[model samples]
Target: MPNATTVTEVGQFLKNPPEGFTVEAFGSEYRVHCSEENLVFIDNFRSGDCDIVFQNSLGRKLKMHNLWEYTRMRKSLLSKRIYVLVSLCDQNIPESSKKEPSEPKVLQKYVLSIDGGNPRIKWQMERGLDWTISSVAGESYRVEIDLSEILESLAAAGVIAENLMKCNPIWKDSSFSLKYYSDALFDFPHWFGFSKRSFKLRLIKNT
Candidate 1:
């Protein structure tokens, strides 16, 4: 069971997670942390069928067939909204065949390199983090977050293409507004952008 204080601490830790924390879900002590890979896994796990696990410093394993259940449980214990940030590395293009005719290729490196050029970064925020803490749970809680807000925060963080910036170096202040992107440019393609950037936000929850 997690408490309000524990929830806050976990969120903070994720914002600036300690170094050397691998994405493995097992073989670790009981502490809360997150990584880009882990977040992606969780997101996909919730939307589809999959399993996830985490290990604590003590090298104990915690397995969950469905992360949505645990995510809800965490929210139930919190009094404030919890923000989730996910960063990914951009992929590099593969070498093409010189002699034989081949189909056009796309890179799959996914690792972003700043040395090449400044890559646009994207971030997402979960607008409202709602949860419930029941005394009967003996300290455990459940959590629910609006996915819409998460997508908004990510777009707000600048998920637009790098080439677009070349044409117009500056973007309108409202360019990031959720309504604008959700309605105006909902079908815009996200390309030639960096992914390894960091994102942070507070969890705002009501009483």
Candidate 2:
């Protein structure tokens, strides 16, 4: 498992991505220019499980199913800087896994990373949003969101929606019964201001 230090290191890397490095959000890949001698490519694949694949300009390829294995194997070949970059790129694995289980455990979390500068933004927005779902055994699902960062993002983006700034908004204590939607397909859209940009959610039930 990755610890806080690892997560923090990754966050710092993103705050100031190194030169000649670029991240592809759609494919979840990182391209790094190691040096004139070597170039590194990191790609993430999601099947039933998550996997990380690394390749170099020299045509060498390495794949690891988990971070522990990847860290250990690449220690010799990768420098401290390169290692941190790779580790940060792999941090998304745990985030993606948070939604894997059919039933919510004690608490399940989902993180949304927003681009404040996305040309589509019409107002202020949140850059990082954390959505948490809590359930007790088989009881109703309780959903809550951490909105501080979102408010800041919105303000930064010049979004002027007053409703978004109200205290303890509806999202704070929203509840839903798992049994009600157990058989039907449902979609929920979280709209940001008047912009057509929204997060569309599709519910999937396990049989």
Candidate 3:
């Protein structure tokens, strides 16, 4: 049996997740750190999936078959929330994409956060990290997320576009995501977003 655990250390959680563990969604680069619970999904990525075209990583591509196995494996634990705590890595102004009007070149790369325009960049980082706590239970045939964690820019332009279509507060908030275009955007974050986003889907069809 795979050891079911509640891991704290990222290293322990991921068996040597390669540096630059980044993904793209909404035409932006997002670094994702996933802490899994009763889900052995990552290990299933055998360093790469050649069959999955247009994928960035060498790990095997995840398919509906994998979801079936994940569901089957967790049926006994439906009483417990089988979930993951996924954290997106932050980027500083310098590390941010240059496709936009990147300013303050005086500062060293990564010297400031991507939200260099925000007066409260430091404070915002503490309280405004883009994170999602996704959990699924037997009662609901879908994933559930905390609404407060919705990233407006990401949801509108890329992932979860429909749910956040009405969001407008982002325009006023200087701390809103830069939402720049980048070549790094790929399958990873899109999958991560859906895996965590609250949505309904039929995993099985009734005969």
Name the top TM-score candidate.
3
TM-scores of the models, in the order given: 0.22, 0.19, 0.23
Model 2 misplaced regions, further than 4 Å: 1-15, 19-41, 45-75, 78-207
State the lDDT of candidate 1 residue by residue for 122-201, as single tens digits.
11222222112122112222222223333333334464344432332221111111110112232222122211122223
The predicted structure with the larger TM-score, 1 or 2, is: 1
Ranking by TM-score: 3, 1, 2
lDDT of 2 by residue, 130-158 (tens): 12212122222212212333433433443
Q: After superposition, how far is residue 42 of candidate 1 from its true place, in Å?
A: 1.8
Q: Considering summed lDDT, which 10 consecutive residues are worst modelled in model 1?
A: 109-118
lDDT tens readout by residue for model 3, 12-83:
323333233323333222334432222222222211221111122212122322334445433412322222
The local distance difference test score of model 3 is 0.26
RMSD each, Å:
16.8, 20.2, 18.3
